[model samples]
Target: MPRFTSRPLAAAVLAGILTPAIIAPHAAAVDYGMDPDVVQNPADTPNRPETSGSGPSMLTQGSSDGTVTEGLINDYRPQTVNPMFPEGRDHLPTADIDMDPEVLARLAEYAKVDGDRIRQINAYSPSMGRTIPLVWIVPQDLSEPRPIVYALGGGDGGQGRDNWITRSDMVDFYSEKNIHVILPMLGAYSYYSDWLEENPDQGGKQMWETFLTHELPGPLEAELGADGTRSLIGMSMSGTTALLYATHQPGFYDSVASLSGCGDTNSWLGRRGVASTIYNGNGTPEMMWGAPNSDYSRYQDAVINAGRLAEQPNLYVYAASGLPGDLDFLGPNAPADDGAWDDRRGPGFYIEAASNLCAHRLKQATDARGIDTVYYDFATTGTHSWDAWNNALREFWPIQARGFGIDGGSVTPGLDGEEAPWVGSSDSSRYTDLFGPSSEIYGGSTAPALSSRLDDPSLSSQSSVPDGSSDSSGSSGSSGSSD
Candidate 1:
């Protein structure tokens, strides 16, 4: 990952008046249209007091005849808890079941013969603390190691774990497809980043990037027989993390699918944004990047990274959004026709702005690289919410399944070689290419570790290779996500 060099906090391009960022299917639907003027200078000024007389603190204004009238005031309070943040994963009570031991036994027994069932597994993140609150459902019928699909809530409207998966149709979909499903407990505001600056100890508790790419996989391999056949499919923020993970750690996952994911970290924070207070004081893009306007390093806009991964043909990409009415949480009660503005109580408030730009740039970049790309533009009336994501997920599954070398017909190579694996960055400064080397953390493992472990067939022999035959890009996979 190249360090961010600029600091004029990249402003979010809004959809329209009274609307949030949005990526609708229709060309006339106005996926996202922002007034460039809305962007602000990050260094302009800190939140200074602009006071008027109206009682003790309220900002009031003197009318034409010196009459005092209460007027709008600008008092920026620190955002301690993000509304988009899930309630709490700190000490989330685990199910009474002993998941790890049971899963290992099941894997040992199943390795002999082909079988499938309610395969229970655990997922961990160092920042999420010691307890393993995450559980997965793997179908029994898969012959080889299937693609891993990670689902969660947090970005835009999909935050909080309690209702995130249950509220939608994903659990059923996973069961139907037999795709290895990873369900993490990301509530609304947790961007799933290892927040180094937010902790009092600066312990990097939020270092989920390390856990997912390293710690969690070992257990999955021990239990469910995961041999690098992985894919992350999620909504909103988790969706963005899916792409960032693919970009930062190439060769880890064969494909990445994002439904209504954000394009840049700065989009979440308004212009002149605060790092710690809003993102839980875990070091804003500036702090994470070690300079001003450094959001790119953390979130890693897909537009920039995809170009770097151009050679990696196995890197499949998919993005989609729902029609207008389909996006409403409660159907008609939530109207889809809100212009791009901050109508907090209204539907499509925040997600609209971010996902629109993200999907657009992601598609543009992938398409330019001649990477096999799939973009579904559903039409109807909807907003930026789970309902929309659910719809989008259903539409996206076919593409995702194909990426796993499942849905698509046997992928025969063309006479001309398909895309090759992306090599590390040519620029020494930006060494963290999609599958390149990087600094280590949390005792994380590298692609080399995965390769070395492949020598033994402790897992299924079929699990060694990714699905059907494919080309190798010789890329080294690592871990990371935008805070």
Candidate 2:
């Protein structure tokens, strides 16, 4: 009967005095909904796709030479043989590890009932000065060593142990299809790039490239019992890094995936505003690249450099956004506070580099290439959170699976059902070479709450959400990826 004027005080008093027997279970936090309707597994999607709007239209703009650059056309880049590895990485050692009992047990405990096998191990990168911890996931039944798909983490770098191997939507997708997955843990702040400056005795100048491309493959090959031919998939920051590595060393990866990882170091350092953080607080973009404002300065913009990503045989590229229209959380109004420019507010603001201008240029370059690239724009609603990425993992796995010569039908709802829009593949306006025999773009009436997990700027992590809630919408129709 006493006045309960203060909420916090009342909560504390009740919590302290109330025992389990006295307090009732709170129903406010519980969400009760009808059982979800299950559809056919997406991997089993039928091929009878609805075709609309002229089949596979060419996005090619004219060049003076008059050769059509649309469709499957031959493209090339002047290969620069790393003088360091002239004979190739034949000298690199083979990776061998007996899985620790603890890691093995955990892997088995969380073993996806869907027949996914997960392995946790470490690879030392002498160039990067640390042991690159990795988690490898394979389907339980596959005897033959399959092509590896390398997935890079987004934060300062995450421990690959329990990160996603045991529980990622993408890995699950691949595992179900029998594709091998390798997740590596680079230094958190490293952004998978070689430090321009040295870190102790480790190699510095883009040494990650050497470790990933030249050094680790031998051991990985030996461990997997196959030659180290693999694919590259990156999310957010790693996404850009994956593309850079693939473009620099074209033949290593058969396919490339960039999930919410558009733009480059310029975008991260310049527009994303982490330049000084990347350079160890000793350098700014202006100092590192001569003049920050100069377009021709050192370290050319990655988006602009994308034009050079031409010419990889059997190259499959995929770029996607959880939400379109400048990512909502990015750009000038990101933090909405002056304190956002804490470290060095110099020329390396990555947010600036990730601008509409940057986004437009990147789209243009990718589109110019006649590669089979797919730019999925889930612009209706969502954020740059892991939940959105998880859904992307669903959509992306199907797309990537398709690239691996694995064919299937639509797994999610809407695209295959009666209300579906243009099916059987078309080019997104954002990119050129990205194509599919069929594609679905949709929008969600409600953005999933999972995106908020990555809402924290201090700890660059993404959130998780339920599947099929995030929507992808172009101007025409909306679709969901529940499968």
Candidate 3:
């Protein structure tokens, strides 16, 4: 595992250098029109500054000034008691019953699709005292239990019950292979983690990690015929969450795939980007993990914890440079011939470029640890949009199918000949290239010890081959609401 040996930097640097770029007021209308199915028009929903803001702080004036005062900074300090969890509950709690039948019945009304049978499970979360909507797509055949493919939607704050059916052909693809699909309706900017406090923007307790990993499986297995084995694939914000979850809970997923995700949450730039994203979504950073450079932030840093991912049986990491490609104009949301690319295509491209840089950092960490199961696909040209993600999902399906022990029919061409792109070594120089030599980003010239255990030659020699059995299960449960 890679390491960071330098002393932590002052929080003032983050406030001084990072906040301005993140919170600058918007000059134009924020576009949620990229995926109408996943995001509603900002005009359709009333502007609620108390909860979900109008738009990104940098893009809207009414949003909160993205500043962290000294008092709020202190809140990041470790608390004597975690407010989100129940008192005296040191471990994860379990669900006592299956999903409420009434909720399922309500969801059943919308499950009538052409090809596959879609069902809704009102997964109960003890931490939040509410049930989260989980949409499942089960194949028509009931011959046996099927391995599950957990697909997470990007940050859009709307109910994503129809994302798989509407956004892409995931339903048809998975159904044909007899694989079950689970799409949790995570609110737009949840980031899918156990927050330090209840989110003001999205409301409800943000205990997504607990729910996705611990609570939802039993009901899925018992009621939905889902075998214990699973693969997790997420794009954009959820992409980052997927990687973090996999790292935090090793062996929890047979395979993990990240599409255009920012994985390096500990770096100065990375931290600022995520802080901006949270604040723009009308969420407070202190509520999610704490102040910048907090211990909880470090704990949630996927790059810092990439060593755990090295132990996974399979991994797929992808990102595109912020440049237009031949395929960019082929999707439903293709750029218009007009100059809308200046606003629509340009910003997403750069965001994805930064995310790709983070993915590069993850690649360096995984490479340094000598993990060989990783399949990294870095394109030279592309933008951050659903089309790219949809294509990535289709391209990576065969690899995911193999990991889940399913034979995905008719392998997509050019997949076998694809080479994992290399992004230099995991060294101080590489860090400089990505974020410059400023102490604000690098902290020091040397990398700190991310995980000493990963450096052990004996441990590195152990096979990361996952147990192909479908009986394994993990534990916890929690819930949250969308903005």
Candidate 4:
């Protein structure tokens, strides 16, 4: 994924906003237009400070006559946590229960650091009529209401295991940021969408849309101290779902980030992506959304429903062109790449290339309609793996910090250094014409490894295609409702 910046000239744009930087569907203002960055606005400033104050540093006299007023001062600092954020994950359809063995083993890896802050929370989603396991991360310092950042993994949605966390440093990084993070252990193979029908093979009615937007947040926010703000981020397969979720509900998530995620899923390539994701999960499209180009299937497309995002002028839209960047091969935090079909590096090249194509289409669609809130991180060079995504989380955080009331100043800007993935320079339109719009595989520098892997006919025939489709430029698909 590219660094989080403007759709084009991302570095220069961020340099301007660091120099600076969501939609709402469900309605009423969530943040009340409160500026969360600065502790105080300081309406007035003097060239120099007086050596001596009137009394114990309580002076607010800027009048020409110099009269001091003590009793009229009101500090806007948070006295207690936001009524929404402090509640913890609230009343549930089911009580918190023991985590699955696999999940527990995963949690064991982080026990030494802040494992105690994480608790296993099992909540029932009546929409799906099943138990959804969630990893609830309560911030260590609850002095103020914190924004809840809901992160979803791509491809099989982690197959019931925490996907990206196990592959990248996401869990560790967010753990120290004092944000309440919720990772749901559901939607394996599904796109985390509310399907029309359950797959007969990998069958289970999935109301992920309702479960996440309606059922899950209410009780969690009520009891967990939500601060009336949320940020939903997704990668790979779930990336499309994340973008769709923002359009699904207005004013719900103030911030939305799609790292190397596709926002257009109505094209032939898009349909294939959905199909392949289901196939890997051992399901079929007939059960999920019926035939391709069906009326119901179009409703699930992100670009088709993007106009809904324009309703939210303040929405933070972040996406990336899945080209190779500094973090891919040399990433210090990513798991080792063995160059196998399943390894993060090898297939990631083409998969991310596909996502890169999908991203450009969405960028044009959003731009054509004047949807300017988008921050498209078009990496000049990245793979479609955890390494790119982990960097994206850190990069997107600072931009979101000010709005979410966290001090964005604490998050450092990623420079040209290899370690800094958030480097400002970004553009989303890199490969829209590379080897024709129909081609999804383009090797920037990561081509060698992919070529070597594909050289072996045995491995080449056995490798599971990443998106299972080309990241082509055909924007035509079934019509959808943006509302």
Q: Give the Cα RMSD of candidate 3.
A: 12.5
Worst lDDT run of 10 residues, candidate 1, spans 1-10
Better of 1 and 4 by lDDT: 4
Model 2 Cα shift for residue 179 (angstroms): 1.9
In model 2, which runs have C-alpha deviations exceeding 4 angstroms? Answer: 1-116, 160-167, 200-206, 226-229, 267-301, 313-359, 368-378, 408-483
Candidate 4 residue lDDT tens string, 46-129: 232233322112212211111111121111111112122235233434222223212333233322113466654555666556
Q: Could you give candidate 1's per-residue lDDT for residues 167-286 as a string of tens digits?
A: 455556776666667654322233455443443322224555556665566565555555456676655556666666666655566666665554333222211122221233223344
Candidate with the greatest TM-score versus the true structure: 3
Please give each candidate's TM-score.
0.51, 0.52, 0.70, 0.63
Number of the candidate with higher TM-score, 1 or 4? 4
Model 4 lDDT at residue 402: 53
Candidate 1 global lDDT: 0.36
- Candidate 4 has its poorest 10 consecutive residues by lDDT at 12-21
For model 3, what is the error of residue 175's alpha carbon versus the real structure, in angstroms, after optimal superposition? 1.1
Arrange candidates, best TM-score first. 3, 4, 2, 1
* lDDT tens digits by residue: candidate 2, 93-133: 53333333123222233322122255555555555444444
The better-scoring model by lDDT among 2 and 3 is 3
lDDT of 3 by residue, 78-131 (tens): 122233343533376754333323332223333332223665544556775654
